[model samples]
Structures are given as structure tokens and as C-alpha cells.
Target: MAALISGAIDLGGTKIEARLFDHAANTQDMRRVPTPRDNFDSFLAALVGQIRWLEQVAGDPSLPVAISIAGLIDPRTGIATASNIPVSGRNLSRELGEALGRDLPLINDCMAFAYSEAHGGAGEGAATVLGLILGTGVGAGFVIRGDLPPRHAGLAVEIGHLGMPARALARHGLPIWPCGCGRDACNENYTSGTGLRRIAEWAGLSDPDPVHVAGRAATDPEAARVMEIWADLTGEMLYSAQLMLDPQVIVVGGGLSNIPGLPERLTGALKRLRLGQVSLPDIRIAAHGDSSGARGAALMAKAGKA
Candidate 1:
């Protein structure tokens, strides 16, 4: 039999990355193009073009394709909702599959990240892994034994949308802020990289970029204080997540995870909130970096084929 190969696409707000990979997650060929933001038709065309290009490069017209999209796809309705993409509320899977004459599995990007880490990246060897992303916004994926837990309505693990703990908000004198999701006091408003900037601004800092704030944490007392609160708020969320999921390992990814000494600071905060004799969960940085999404999509395709 011919070696099994699959095509994967990582669909983000700014760009779409397509790759062909073997069963082992090795990249065979890859291409990238700007994501179409003007209309759904243009966006669909871009995906069709990328998949066709991949099939041509592989010389296999029947290659399975999977997408890791920065959005949610309701399994019941096949409708997708992404803040950055134009496909919101559309049955993207059906449309794209019809255009290509093949079934295309759509996985949430964070879920893909978790699957990738659980298989061979940071969460390798762990029975349950929580892939946490702390970038412009916050999101997470829960995986157990190399597979995601069953999800209903595509929202089982939307931890970012949960409300902030009232006590924590009161402690920091922070007001409940509105979230893009049309809810107030969502965790994303206070724990994301954007949230870090919000904290900096609240503290009267001139620079609100999370990178600059984290960089100045060492010498700048105000910046240090901002990060401290950020860490505390972030830790509060993780504390609840840890209790709920009891994951064996928590893999941190996304831009904010790059902050220096972040894992240690988070661990410290967790220690402070320890309720009993439960051991602190192991926290590690993501190993696959940006490629994890695409690689994971390919892996999902390959697994489905099996």
C-alpha cells in the first residue's frame, strides 16, 4: 500500500498555512497565503486553492484534508463562529467539502494544539493534558489519552468565556469589563495578553503591550505590579480549571506563554491558592510552536483514515 499522506490547514486571522504530512507528523510540503477577510466566497476560494495546490504537490488527488481553524464549529449544526474569519455562522465544513468533493474535518485550533502536545510535544506521556493559550485572547483544549473529550455544541472547553471570580476582581479593585463575546467579566478580558495591557493601562502605564510590560517587570515597579496581578488573575482561572479537569499536565502556548519565568510565577500563585494536599499540576511550554496546529490537523486526518 502507498504511504498514507494527509493535508492540513491552519486557518488564522492573518494567514492560512497548508501542509502535507506523513503519519508521523513530518512535513512533506507546505505553503502559506494571506487569509481572505473580505467575504465568505473569497475565503472559501482560498481554502479550495490551497487544498488543490497541496494535492498537486503530493501528486495525490484523494489526499484527506483537515483544518485547524481559530474558531468554533458546532457539531450539531455545522455552523462556525470565528471573530477573525468571515465564515462565522456558515456551515464551513459542508461548503468546503462540497467544493473539494471530499470530507474535511474541522478542528478548533486550540484543540489541535492540545492534541499535538499530547501526542509528541510538551504533554507527551501525560494521560490528561490541558493545552492553554494566552495570546491576544485566551482559550484552552482538554485532551485525554491522546484524544479530545466528547464535546457538545462545540463549547465544552471554552474556559475563556467563563465569568471572573468575584473575589479576585474585588481583591484587585478591577471592574468587570465587557468581552467581545458580548458578556461582561469574562476571563478573557482580564487574563489574556490583551488583559495584561488592560492591567498596565489601569495602573497608569504608558506602554500597554504585554511584551513591553513583561520585559520591564524586573526593574519597573509598576510593570512588576501589573504582571503580578496578571499572574494572580491567570492563576485563579487555572486553579479552577485544575480542580475541574485534574489534568496530568498543563501545556502553555500562545504569545503570553513566552514571558520569562511565567511558569514559575504561575506555579507560585497556584501554591498560594492550594486548598489541600493535592499536588501542583506540571506546567510546561509548548514544544511544537506555530506548527502545532497544522501538524495536529494532519494527525487528525490520518487518525480518521485509520
Candidate 2:
């Protein structure tokens, strides 16, 4: 008999990815589709269609399904809030499950990334892992002893929304900018890929692509200055995180993490900010890359079954 498989979906701002995987987290089949940003009906249809397609392809009609979404779901109310997706204030799991005629587990994408890393990715041997995502935005999740801590009202680690340190802002001579979350000087406004682009633009760089900006830092004085400020701001945040969580390893995943020498730069920044004689945790790139979210969602479904 074939081993049982689980279905996983990673719902992002621009796309939705679905996959079929086994207990070992190996993908059996995968599919991707553009997300319907404004139409709820289209969004539901997209997800339902993908799952049905995967089921047909795998020849398994009863596989458990799990979702990793870039948003927060209130476990108490079952309502979800995703800025980019159209499911804000709706019971996504219930509605999506009803559409498919099966219950489905949903998790935050950052948490899923963290779980995947903590289990067998970059943080395999560590007792605690901090999964930090520096994508279009910033977000983090913590995994302790192979499990995620209980979240209340979907509020676990919202470090992105925290206020940026005044010292770092003043040192960089950057203005306090408003965040998408309606707050000024939030860390996401400066530490994410979007933030990097904004910083580059503020530094008078016509090219605001984060990758280009980071790549040109060695040659362009303006780009180098922007990188320095970005690194300082990010390093300050990580310093606070190190003090609070002290995870054995910090696994960085997202678009910005792919920049070459990012970990080394961050390490240098951290070393400069060191206050005591304590050593810092290992900073490693995520092992699973883009697939970590979907794969982790599948693992969550498998764990739920056991």
C-alpha cells in the first residue's frame, strides 16, 4: 500500500501554491495559481480548484489539507486578517473547508517556515529556532523543542510591527515613516525588502530594487550608505530579539535573505552592537527556501493526524 499523503497550500499576496506531500515532506505534486485579490468568490474557487486538482493527480480523495497564509487567524473567533488577501475578518478555514467538504488546518506562514526549519531544516539540531522572514515585509516565528508555543488571538511574534529604535533612526538621519499598519516608525517600514527599496529611494537611488541596491552597495556610495543604515536598523531589532528569545539558531527566509553576504553583514552588525561577553546564535539561511511554507503546512497536517 502507498503511504498516506497530505495536501498543503501556501497562500501569498500574489499567488497561491498547492502541493501533495508525504510524512517525509517530499513533494509528490505541486501547482501554482494567481490569487484573486479583490473577489472572495474567485479566491475560494482558486483554492478549491487547486486542492481538487492535486487530489485527482495524486489519486487520493481524502487527504488532509492544511494552509499557510500570510496573515493572522484568531483561534478564538476563527476570523482571519490578511492585508494583501481578501479574507480579512472572515472565517477562512471554515468557509474554505465547507467549500471542499472537509476540515482544514490553517497556520501563519512565518510560523510554518519556522516549524519546518526547526524540525529538519537549518535549525535541525537546535532546541529553539527563530524563523525570521525579510520578504516584502518582516515577520517572525519561534519554535521550541520541536513545537510552537500556544498563540493567543493569533498574536505570537509580531516583531515587524514593533516601533523602531529611536537611537538607530537618529543615527541614520532617516525620517520616521508611516507603516502600512497605520503606525509610524514600525520596524517593517525599514527592515523588510520593501523597506530596503524605500531606503534606497530616500538615498536618491533611482533603482529601488532591493537586490540591485544590495548588489551595488560595494560600488555605489549611496547604495552602500543605504545598506549601512538598513543593517543598523535590522541589527538593532535582532539585538532586542536576541535578548528576549535567545534562540539557538535564527533561520532567515524571504526575498532579502537571498542577498549574498547578508548573514555576514548581519553578523558584523550584531558583533558591533554586542553589550556583554555573550556569544550570538547561529544565523543561517532557510534550508527549504520557498517550499518551506507549503511543506511545513503539510507537516502540520501530518502532526495533527498523529
Candidate 3:
């Protein structure tokens, strides 16, 4: 039988990526464009152009589309709520459907990561899997039995907003790690790439870049202090995850996941937090790097299920 073609959309704060994939989830073609500014119509138009490009490459206008986007979406209404992008609180699936003259499946970006990980990444063969993304923000998804994808109920696991004293200490209520969604301590304020910068500043180091600060942490005492705090906070978050789902594997993705020593530091912290005799959850960096979300979005398209 001929392989099926699928289209995937990854809507990030800074860019929107669309790609065409085959049944094996190999990306056949892809394009990425900067996310539009405040104009909603303009953003839609930009996305449409990307889709058109993918269509031209794959020669399949009727290709099944699966979407992954930052922020929260009401699974029932399919409305996307993103603060950084222009499409916040809008029903993206409905909008795309209206534009393309057909319905499209939309899932949270983190859920897509979990889906992809379950299929081929660290979560393979795991009954319960937890996917964690620490990028411009932090988010999570729980996959059961590696097949039954979790429903997008507007509440799978906004783990970033799990609340941390670090958030208030660093962001000081600024839009710095904004979480008006009313969750306390907001984990993103400390662990995200942006949040890590805040941690650096709080430690009296002036490096405004997360990558730079993480690098400095290796030699600079103050910067290392900041990382230690981040490690503790992240370890606590993982412990929370371990207690709740007892996932067989935890796949960590996003920009911060690439920072040197992050995996070991977080793992060591988790070891310190161990409860009586429970086996530590196997934790590892996502096999896919920063492109994990985009790739996962493509995988979602192939699966054709949310």
C-alpha cells in the first residue's frame, strides 16, 4: 500500500513550523516562518502560506493535519490560549478548518511530545509516560500504555504553573513568567530558558542569556548557585510527577534540556528526594532536541489522532 501523507503544525511564540510527513513519520518537507506580531489575520495568513508550501511539496491538499501549539487550549472548544503568540484564546482548529474547508486535529504541544516519545523516544515500552518540556516555558503530558493518548481537557498538566517560591522571587509579578491562569509558584518562572535568566540575575550575575548563564554556572560560583536552586526546584517537580503518575519514563525536552549537567543535576536531586524504596523513574533528555516539538507535531499528523 502507498504511504499516507500528513501535515503537522507547530505554533510557537517565535515561529510557526509546518511540515509534511509520511506514514513512518519521516519529514518529507518543512518550512518555518517567524510568528506574526499582534495581528491575528496576519498570523493566520503566515500559517496559511506555510501550509500552502507543504501542500505544494506533498501534492496532497486533503492531507490530515495535526496541530501543536504553545499555551492552553480548551479541549472541548479547541480554543488556544497563548500569551506570547497572537492566537491566544482562539479556536485554532475551527479557524483552520474554516480556512481549509475541513476539520483538523489540535493537541497541546506537550501532549504531542509525549505522543512522539511514547512511539519512539525514551518512553517506548513504558506503560505510563510523562513528557516534560522546559523551553520558553514548561509543560507536561501523561500518556497511558503508550497508546491511549490523554484527552485535551484544558487541564492535562500545566506543570509549569505548579507554583514555586522561585517564581515570585525572580519574576516579581512581571510578565517575566506570566501565569495569570491562577496557578501558584509557577514552575516556569525558574526552570524555563527565560526563567533561568531570572535566576541568574537573582544570583547577582548579569548574564541575561539562559545559555550563557548555564555555561557560566560551570565556573562562576554565583551562577552555579543559581543552577543549584534550579536543580532543587526541578528535582522537586520531578518528585511531584513521580508521586502522581509513577510514569515508567520521563522524557525531558526543550531548550534548557541541552544545558550541560542538567540531566545529571536533576537526577541527583531526585535521588535525594527519594521516598522509601521506590525505584527512581528513568529520566533522560529527549532524543529529539529543540526540534522535538516540531517533530512531534509531525508525528501527531501521522497518527491522525489527538
Candidate 4:
């Protein structure tokens, strides 16, 4: 018999990516296609096509699929509701599974990221893990002894929306910008790319992107100052999670995590607040980097974790 194959799709607003992974975490036929945001039929077709492609390449007739989405994916109902994706409030998994004749597992993107790291990535070997993304937004996924709950409704580790106290923002002299969620001064104001842009303005910057802010932090004193404030605010954010969940290891992913030396800086901030930490929990960058979503989707399919 041909080796059993596992597959996954990372569904994004702009693109849909499908990947196949062997038991060893090695990938094959990684493929990407435009997401048909306007039409649900087109979107489903894109996913099915990718699955067929991967199965053909691997010579497996029936490939199990698990998906990672940026928003809430309810495996029970197979419905998805994401802010950016147009297909909000639709039975994505159930409908897709009907088309494919199989019950597909679906997980939130953050959970997938966390599951990936927890199983074999940076968070490997840790009983409790926080898979955090410090990129366009600040969010996390919690894994308890490798169990990732599938029906989070996208709110389990949504750390970005938690507001930073006015007192905290006062220290950095940053303005209380309104969040997309209609709240003023949510954590996203200081921890997301938009937040980074706003923080950069405090250092007299204009429209600086996350990459620009991270790159200049090394050479420019003003930029360095902003990052310090960013780190402090972020530290505050992570500290709250530590107090609540007390994850054993934190694996940082996303665009901001790629900044050289940032992982160390974030580690220091978390450790400082750990309160006489007995061997501070490990904080490290994501080992699989951007591939965590797709890879984790496959893993969840193979393990039935979702």
C-alpha cells in the first residue's frame, strides 16, 4: 500500500496555500493559489484543486485535510468568521468536507501555529506552550500538553484586543488610538504593525512600516527608543498571559519576531516580570517561521488534534 498522506491548507484573505507533509515533517508539492474572496464556490474549488494536486504528487487517493484560518473556525459547525476574509459566517469546513467526502478538521491560524511549535517546532518538549505571533497583530495560541482545542471561536488567545492601561501608555507618550474593535487604546495600538507605526511616530517617524521600524532600531537612537517602548508594552502584554496561563515555553512568530535580537529583548522583558523566576520559561523565535500555519494544519490532520 502507498504510504498514507496528510495534507493541509492555510486559508488567507489574499491567497490559499496547500501543503503535504510526511510523518517526518518533510513537505512536498507546496502550492499557492489566489483566494477567490468574492465567490465561495471559487474558494472551495481552489482548495479542492490544491488537495487533488498534492494527492496526485504523493500518489495517495484519499488525503486528509486540516485547515488554518486567521479567524474563528468552528469545527463543530464548520463555519468561519474572519474580519479580513469575505466568507465570514459560512460553513467552510462542513461545506468543503461535503465536497471532498470527508470530515475535515479546521483550526484557527494561531492555534495551528502553536500546535506546530508545540509538536516539533520551537516549543517542542515543553508541556505547556504559547505560540505567539508578533506580526501584523499580537495574538497567541495555547497548547496544554499538546492538546489544542478546536472550537475557540477565535477568542482563546486573542491578546491583541486587551487594552493597555492609560498609565502604561503614559510612560511611552503614545496616543490612545482607537482599535478596529471600536475600543480606544487596545493592546493592538502598541503591539501590532499599526501600533508600531504609531509608536514610531512618538520617535518622530512618519508612516514607518514594521520592517522599517525593526531595521532602524539597530542604528537609529530614536528608533531604538521606540522599540524599547514597544518591548515594554509587549512585555506587559506577555506578562498578563503568564499570570493567567503560565505557559512553559513561548515561541514567537511573525514579521516582528524576525528582527535580529528582538527575541532576546522580549525574553528579557517576560523574565523580568516572571517574579524571581525559577528557570524562566524558554522564549524563542518560531522554528518553522511562516510555514507553521500550513505545517500545523497537516499535523492536526494526522493527529486529529483539531
Candidate 5:
């Protein structure tokens, strides 16, 4: 039998990307289309049209489409409860599948990231891997061997939304800042790119961008102090996650992960917070970088399931 093609859709608020991958989940072709944010129908139309376009390019109408979205979808109900997108609080996949005349496989953005890293990227060969995103916003996912841990009620490995560590909070004197997840003092509020800038603001720095702060951390004493606090906060978060998931490697991704010396800082903080715990996981950066989600979604297309 001929190998199947994997059609992947990475949906965001602003645009929808359509790509085709070979059996090994390597990209063969890709294109981008603007997202329709007016309503669910428009959103569905955007994605469905993109999928059909990809099929035409592949010259194979049987290509399975896999979708990656921001929030987790309820597996039992097929309901996608995403934020920032117009289709939030709706069963997007089932509806899209109905329109497309096929059973579409879907996964959360974070889960896709983890799956990509675990299977062939940074976490390859590890028994267990944690994909952590310190991106524009913080997120995380867990992959055991080559599989993602089963989620309960569409919630799994959402370590970033957990409350700020009490110790880190006490030491840093951070306020109860609001989070997009409708919570205050969440890990994402401190561990993400905005979080780093927030720390700069609290420290009275005029430049609230992470790039500026990271650039100055080498020579400016105050920037170093901010990073120290960030390290402490991230350390507590990772240590707490380790106590629960015990992953063999935590692969860090996202914009802030590009900050030089961040991996070292994160590892140093983890060590300081672990209380000398044994069997420490190697903290690492993502190998696939920004493409993990699309690639992993393509993998799901080939797998025929999440």
C-alpha cells in the first residue's frame, strides 16, 4: 500500500497554516491563509478550504487532516474550549470533520509541541519528556516515551496556569497579576515573555521588553537581578512539576527560551529548588523551535488519532 499523506492545520487567531507531511511527518508543502474570526462558520470555512487546498497540492484527496489549536478539546465531547479565537466554547473538530467528510484528529498546541520534541526533536530517546513553552504566554505538556499523557476533562500538564510558588512569590514581592486563564498570580503571569517584562516594570526598568532585559543582564546589575527573580520563579515551578510528573527531560521552547543562558539559569534554579533531589532531568531547549506544533499535528494525521 502507498504511504498516506499528513495534512496539518495550525490554527491561530490571526492566520491558519496548512501543510502536508510525508509518512515520517516531514513537511512536503505548506501555505498560510488568513483566519476568519467573525464567527464559527467563517472559521470552519477558512480551515476546511485550506485543507482542501492542501489536498489539491498533494494531488491526493485522501490526505488526513490533523489540527492544532490553542486550548484543549474535551475528548469525550469533541468540544474545543479555546481562547482568543472566535470558536471558543464550541465543538470545532466534529463540526469541521462533518463539513470535510472525514474524521479529523486534533491535539492541543502544547501537546503537539511535546509530541514533536519527544518523538524526533529535543526530547528524542528520553523515557519521559516535558515540553515547556515560555513563549508569549507560558504553557506545558508531558510526553511519556512517544506518547502524551492522557488528559482529564481536556486539562493535562497545564503547569503554567498553576498558582505562583509561595516561596518565589514571597521572595520576589510580585503582585497578584491577572492571567489570561482568568486567574491571578499564575505561573504564566511570571514565567512568560510578558512576565519577564512585568518583572522589569516592578523593578523600575523603563524598558519592559525581554530582549532588552536579556541584553542588559550581561552588564547591568539591575537586569541581572530581574533574571535572578525570574530564575527563582521558574525554578520553583519546574521543581514542583518534577515532583509530580518526574519527566526525564524538560524541553523549553518559545520566544524567551531563545534568551542566551536561559537554559543554564533554569537548570541552576531547578537545582537550587530541588533540595538535592536525585535523578534530575536534563533541562534542554527545543530542537524544532517554532515548527513543532505543525509537525506534530502532521504526525497525528498519520496516526489517525490524537
Candidate 6:
């Protein structure tokens, strides 16, 4: 008899990853592929290739697959809008089913991260979990107790697109940058990796990558100033979540979380921003790196079938 296996796939703007989970729910085999550059056909072909590669490694045709992807997933239509990737607005689930001769489950990438946190990661057993992805762009998802089957109307949160505080920008003397959402001064315009470059450029610094800027902050006052600006921007926006939802724990994920001093910088900023009677929630880096999405996607796939 073929062994039973479940899989999770996380597709982002730059890379795509697929992971297989063992019966014990431990991650087993993993595969990765570069995201397609442009157009739909090449994108679909790349995704199909990834599935085929996973199957080959597992040597089992009966396994189930789940996907966590960037973009808005329409709860009604099951359509996804991966605007950053070529596969935007495509019925990825249907298309994948056709190619693999089986159904594949899909969930928003940030939502998957949220699910992982709520179910098994940092947010486990917490009253409320606010999940954050601070990568190419900012994304958010949330979980509350007693919501059986865990379904939101497919639009829960998107913190990155929030308008940047004009006063903060002017105080720091940074030029405005454009966001994909056709807005100037959106939070993502200054907080994302690309956004970091724009901030550095405006500050007349040669380097803009958050990792490098973080390293330079201790020795260079300019880099420290840039980091302070980011901390302020992030902490200020995070306050919105605190006031609105009052989650017990806020989990931070994505590429930037890997930076060394990030946790200290962000937590200190949070402390500085807390107002009277608004209890500050515990903020920590997401335990899982990129794999959190895949793990949560796998869980979603299991729940969807159940």
C-alpha cells in the first residue's frame, strides 16, 4: 500500500518552496524552485514541475498537497490575486487539480503563518494571535478563539498598505515612495526591503538593505537613525492592531525577522509607543523561518479535507 503523506507549498515573489510532512506531522522532504518571471503559462509550468518533483521524492501518488501563497483569496470564488507574481487572479486550486489529477488546497500565505502560530507556534494557547510577515511586502492575519473551522470573509488584515505617518516622514526628512497599491507614503513604501533602500537613498546613505543597515547602526549614527525610523514606523502601525484587537501575543515573521537586533529594536519601540492602560503584548520572532507558511498550509489542507 502507498504511504499516506501531506505536503505544503509556499509561493512568494522570488522563490517557491514545497515541503512534505511525515505521518507524525514532522517535516520530511523539501524542494524549492525559483518563481516564474512573467506571464501565466511559464508560471503554471513551474508550479507543475514542483509538484512533480515532490511526487518523485515521496514516491507516492496518493499524497495530498496544500499551498500557502501571497495575494488575496476570494472566499466565494476560490480565486487568488498574487499581484506580485505572474499567477495573479488565477484559479490556482483548479489549475493544480487539473495538472496533478488531484485536488490541492490553498490559503493565503500570511494566513498560513497565522494558522501555524495559533495552532502550534508562538501563539499556541494564546487568547489571540496576530501574525505578521515583514518581507517583500507587509502582510497580516489573525485568529480568535471559538471560531470553528476558522474562516474569515477572506479579508481580515493587511497592515503594510496602511498610510505612513506624514509627520514621521517629514520629521525624518525622507522622500515619498510609491506602492503597488498606487498610493504614496504607504507603510510598505518605507518598511520593506526595497523600501529600506529608498529610505537609505533619501538619507544619503550608500547602503539600504535592512541587514546591512542593522549592522551599521551600532557604529554609524546615520544607519541608526534609519533603523529608528523603521522601528517607529513599524511600532506605530502595530499600535493599530493593539487598540483594535488586543491580541495576547503578536508573532513577527518573514525575512527581516532573521536580522540580529530586530527583536530588541522592535520591542523597545513598542515599549516607547505604549499608551496608558493599553497593555503591551509580548512580541517575538516567528520560530519557523520560511517553512511556517508550508506547515500552516499543510494544516489547512488537512482541515479543508476534514
Q: Write the residue-wise lDDT of candidate 3 on 1-306 in tens digits.
A: 146477788888888888777777766667889999788889988887877777667777776677777766787777778887788777877887788777767667888888778887878888888999988778998788865455646765777877664433453333334555655457777778777787677666877688887888878887777787778777878887888778888889888888887668888988987798789888878876655665676776666555
Total clashing residue pairs per candidate?
0, 0, 5, 0, 0, 0
Candidate 4 — what's its lDDT?
0.80
Please rank every candidate by lDDT, starting with the best.
Answer: 1, 2, 5, 4, 6, 3
Give, for candidate 6, the lowest lDDT window spanning 10 residues.
146-155
Candidate 6: residue pairs that collide: none
Q: How many backbone clashes does candidate 4 have?
A: 0
What would the per-residue lDDT of candidate 2 be over residues 1-306, giving only the tens digit for each residue? Answer: 155478788999999999888768888778899999988999999989988987787677877778899999998899999999999988998998799988778899999999989877999979999999999899999999999899888965788999998998998789999999988999989999999999998988999899999998999998898899899889988888898999889999999988889889998898889778788988999999999988888888878821
Per-residue C-alpha lDDT of model 1 across residues 135-172, encoded as one tens digit per residue = 88999998999888877888636889988899999999
lDDT of each: 0.89, 0.88, 0.75, 0.80, 0.84, 0.77
Q: Between the candidate structures 1 and 5, which one is better when assessed by TM-score? A: 1
Across 146-258, the per-residue lDDT of candidate 4 in tens digits comes to 88754434565888888886777887667778887778888877987768877887667774677887788888887888888888888888887887788889898988887
lDDT of 5 at 243: 92
What candidate 4 gets wrong by more than 4 Å, as runs, is 1-4, 149-154, 272-279
Model 4 residue 50 distance off true place after TM-score fit, in angstroms = 2.0
- Residues 162-263, model 6: lDDT tens digits: 887777778677777788997888888877777776777778898777788878889999998888888887887787678777878888998778767676
Give the higher-lDDT candidate: 1 or 6.
1
> What is the overall TM-score of model 5 with all chains considered together?
0.95
* lDDT score for candidate 6 against the true structure: 0.77
Q: Which residue pairs come into collision in candidate 2?
A: none
* Residue-level error in angstroms, candidate 5, position 68: 1.0
